[model samples]
Target: MTGEPSSMFEAIYAGAEAGEAKPPWDYGAPRPQLVEWAEARDLAGGGREALVVGCGYGADAEFLALLGFRTTGFDFAPTAIAAARRMYPASKVNYLVADVLDLPRKWQRRFDLVVESLTVQSMPPEQHTAAAQNIAALVAPEGTLLVLATTRDEGSEVKGPPWPLTRAELEEFASGGLILRGVERIESGTWWRAELSRGAGGSTSHARQF
Candidate 1:
């Protein structure tokens, strides 16, 4: 039998049902830094497909769809997915209730861009490595994996629905044999965004210069 619903999940479902939903991490818009990086690039053009992991209420997914990418969004919580669907009834985004860990092997290397935002840090400590592998597998050859995550330098242990990541933890993608192309830190004097990527070949790379 499935385990009883967690309090966090229950709250999300109730909020959705009551029309009072608000994601804790909701920034009211696609993270401004992400918007800048994505818009500056030539990634989303001419009907490309992009995948969004941990799409809470479809804010980012909505923006991607408007930008011309056929977007698909996944979140583990059903309530959030429902709200997202209603919020974008005419949207082409294929929002679904699915856990990142439970993603099928057949989905490997399937997207032109894998846009992950804070999803990796939400996992339990022991699951971090596997999560990296999953994210890497979703990116096609020559495709870009634009990641936006929080980095902690204090070596603090994370007890959370949002586990903080460190530089060392970010490097775990290389262990899965991904070639990091670049990493850029987005500091708006408020939040930090670490954007990491991997090339098709097996070589680790960084792009902190952006």
Candidate 2:
């Protein structure tokens, strides 16, 4: 079972259930960084598996299905999952209400591609590494992981339920034998897009669920 809801994010989308605005991060479209990366690499899933962590409203998840992936996108917030299903009733993407902190055992190292954008930053700094580990653990052998986040200097101060991540924090995604392949700062260093890959047959047993 998934853990408890993210009260902050839950409240935000809960407002949407009452006909209020979606949270700022819900772009109603796929993440541009992910599209660019996939397009440039000529990445095509061709029925391969993909997972999107903290998939708020299912935009990225639906986008992957268009590229031929058997995609599963999940969010901790029940409201968010409901919104996704409501938004894309005919979509092939599987939208689930699941928490990154508590994933199913069958998911370990099971996805050919994993896309995670902005989800880690929504969590507090204390949970960053654990979130990273779980996200990384979902990648299959020889598969790839893509991560995007709002960027900030390590010592920078900001008032937030959405704390922008530092470079070191982004690096934490290379867990359980996943290699940090490349990293780029975009929009004048205000955003981070990172690509990581796991060596085929490497162990993902180091990952833990809490």
Candidate 3:
């Protein structure tokens, strides 16, 4: 990670300047799994507060906003946030530039639903735990955290950027007073999706559909 862009912001900013499409996990659309979850839970018109982590081009944030959630999308890259705002000019989602590891203190426990898609795996392996802790800190007392990331078997060999997380690593997000409600494998087992709840009193309502 030396000499090369060590942080996501640097990498993405360079990619954007180079006119690359999908820079890193852009996917060009909202995640289908998220759509399914939203539909299953009838999130539309629900008016819940939502936060989108590393909200690349705002697709996921826009989706949540369209569903009546007051969505806020943040990314470490200024270019990414700018592009997201431009891509969805008519959207109500608030797009901002912010680091996942050191988010605004006021944002702690501020959202009812925190959506993290591929954001955790984008960081260096050494930073994964800190990223997870920061992510968990964003959930409200009774909020839900939805995590979607690439997965690898324990002790698997690592390649390059987009290091895949193991099941145990994903479950570790439940630390810091959060509880793991459910874990599912999606995209033909290439991905690990988990639902965690904060202070839900053992209720699995948000994860029951999975």
Candidate 3 positional error at 171, Å: 1.1
Predicted candidate 3 versus true structure: per-residue lDDT over 94-138, tens digit per residue: 999898887999998788899999888888888889899999888
TM-score list, all predictions: 0.83, 0.92, 0.89
Tens digit of per-residue lDDT, candidate 1, span 1-210: 143333466476557578775556877677776788776774454587788998988889888888888888988887778878997889899998888788977767777677888888877767888887788777655556777777766577766767777777776664354555556655742234444444544234432212
Off by over 4 Å in 2: 1-5, 203-210
lDDT of every predicted structure (CA atoms): 0.71, 0.87, 0.82
For candidate 1, list the clashing residue pairs, or say none: 179-198, 179-203, 180-205, 182-206, 182-207, 183-206, 183-207
RMSD in Å for all candidates: 3.7, 4.7, 2.9
> Candidate 3, residue 114: CA error in Å?
0.1
**Tens digit of per-residue lDDT, candidate 2, span 27-101:** 879988888888887878889999999999999999999999999999998889998999899999999999889
lDDT of 3 at 45: 39
- Model 3, 69: alpha-carbon shift in Å? 0.6
Q: What is the lDDT of residue 175 in candidate 2?
A: 84
Q: What is candidate 2's CA lDDT for residue 6?
A: 85
